[model samples]
Target: MTLKHILLGTIGATMIAAPAAFAGSVTPAPADPVVATPVAVALTGDWTGGYVGGQIGFGDVDAGGSDSGAIGGLTMGYDHDFGTWVLGAGIDYDFADITAGGNTLENMARLKVRAGYDMGAGLLYATAGAARADIDTLGNDTGYFAGMGYEHMVTEKISVGGEVLYHAFDNFNGSGTDVEATTAQVRATFRF
Candidate 1:
């Protein structure tokens, strides 16, 4: 045979036989469909319930002079949130013995209204209200108070916070003395 005729015949025969030679070899099966796990979505907190908690901190009373001591108390409140703003009413009572000028003051109470900016897991608030205190030998006295506080939600039902309050009482029960007091406290609350 001529060289060109031989080469063409060999090439044509190889091409015709190649597919048949590999037809019995392993063929890959179609892959199984992948199943994906669903992801959990994070939810934001809502502060629209009644809460009760306790607090402990230091307080300084300046009636004529100044006296500083430790103070602890219980707090309870109900809050209504309006999107970014919150309005609430609360009551708190403290057991403290702060002395100034040989007189000891004990047992303070407050009826307060709170206005706050909601920060998702936290609150920045301003409070104004009425306060009352019992003097050692003197009767109970009433006053006005103003303060600011910050509270953070530790969980869905738990929160921790702190506040600084200034209280002013004029003519403390006919004693002819005006009382001005400041208190700083750390507090925790449980919501329902």
Candidate 2:
């Protein structure tokens, strides 16, 4: 072959091989390091404060037999929160006209201490305390109460809840009669 033919063949071969060589040597840019960012969720408000509320309930009183009626009252309390747990104390007064054994039971009051588990916008609690009940002819008698309750926050300042409580009084009015009561109530509260 003449020099011209040889030169052209060499040049054509170089041109075709150049792209292949470059393609083999080149690598894609390292994909941007996959960064893992944590996502956060919003939770409900805190439960550390003072509160005032009202409740209405119906209960059966057993003094020899059973008598049932409606009861309503006002409640006030303060709570301290510690992470997942809460502690509190409260007082309530109720007016009722429950009759059993030919006697009318009227006013009632309770002082309680409570402990609860915090559940974001809600609380589950248990309470126990001293109670006093007034009877129309038998005067006032002292007793004890225990209960469990659940409350849910509807707003930053308001909550709604329900509770079931049991009360027992032994040898009421110096007589041989005993009293036992169970109450189920719904309540609404405002927090400060």
Candidate 3:
């Protein structure tokens, strides 16, 4: 072959072999570093706080000897939350026309101290408080109450609930005795 043609052939062979020499030996160029932007979340917090609400209660009252009547009225209260536990105290006032063995009561007031556990879906709770009832004759006075309740979160901003309670009162001036009573109620609460 001519020298020029030989030189050209050598150059072509060198060019072909150069890429093969580098095929497995070269490191790929580093990819551009990716920076991710943080995303903000709208809602995050412990649903533990103080709440105030009013409720209507239905209860039976036993004041005089074997006395019973339907009672209902208003309730106001506040609650404190620590994670899944709730501690609360409240006062409920009710009025009922109660009569038994020639006795009648006009207005009754019952105060309660309550505590509960939040099971995520609802609260399992118990309450105890003071009860006082009034009669036209001499203002019959007494104290007693117990209850178990469940409060459910029906919405993000509201809660609806139900409860069953037992009550007792002592008429110190009338018969020197305590009487048994029962109660049930439905309630709703708004959250902020």
Candidate 4:
């Protein structure tokens, strides 16, 4: 065979066989493995009942001067939860012995109205109401107080919280002295 004829024949044979040769070597890519993602579960509680609790903390009073001491008290209230919002009324009492400028403060009481946001198993709240304070020799006076608190449910019937309050009594006991007090306390409550 001549050189030109031999080269032409060899090129034609390769062209016909190229597709089948590469086809057998081709592969399909493997599909990605299935994956599962985790989801978080939300906590919920119903706070539509009566609750009673006890609190203990420190109090600082400014009645012409400043006096600070330990104060403790008992609290009772009823909460009605409206989905994410809660409203309630409560009454509490604290026994204290703080002396300011020779005046001894004996005990205090409050009639409170509370509004809060329900945070699943917890409640973040604000409180305001009338306060009655008794000071030795200065007698008793009525005033107003506002505060904030947080309570978390520990069990179906028990919860714990902390509160900080500001109380103001202008012209305390007819003495023309404005009395202002701040108190911080921790509380534990039982639901009924």
Candidate number of the best lDDT: 4
Residues 1-192, model 2: lDDT tens digits: 999999999999999999888875456767788898998544475889999999999988887778999998999999998989999999989889999888777978999999999998899999999999998867889999999999898888999999899999899879778988898999999999
lDDT of 3 by residue, 80-191 (tens): 7676788887777766777654556677667777888867757788988887767666566776778798887766566778777886666545665555567777777666
Report lDDT (CA) for all predictions: 0.90, 0.90, 0.69, 0.92
Better of 1 and 3 by lDDT: 1
Error of 2 at 26 (Å): 46
- The regions of model 3 sitting more than 4 angstroms off are 1-47, 52-54, 65-69, 174-177
- The alpha-carbon lDDT assigned to residue 71 of candidate 2 equals 91
Candidate 3 minimal-lDDT segment of 10 residues:
41-50
Clashing pairs in 3: none
* Model 4 CA RMSD to the hidden true structure, in angstroms: 8.1
In candidate 4, position 42 carries an lDDT of 43
* Top of the candidates by TM-score: 1
Query: Residue 14 of candidate 2: its Cα lDDT?
Result: 100
TM-score, each model? 0.78, 0.77, 0.63, 0.77
Listed per candidate, the RMSD to the true structure in angstroms reads 6.0, 7.4, 8.7, 8.1
Model 2 residue pairs with clashes: none
Cα TM-score of candidate 4 = 0.77
Determine the backbone clash count of candidate 1.
0
Model 4 per-residue lDDT tens digits across residues 48-107: 899998999999999878999999989999999999999999999999998987877789
Q: lDDT per residue, candidate 1, 1-192, as tens digits?
A: 999999999999999999998786577767899999999644355778999999999989877678899989999999998989999999999999999766677989999999999999889999999999887755679999999999888888899999999999898888887888899999999999
User: Which scores higher on TM-score, 1 or 4?
Assistant: 1
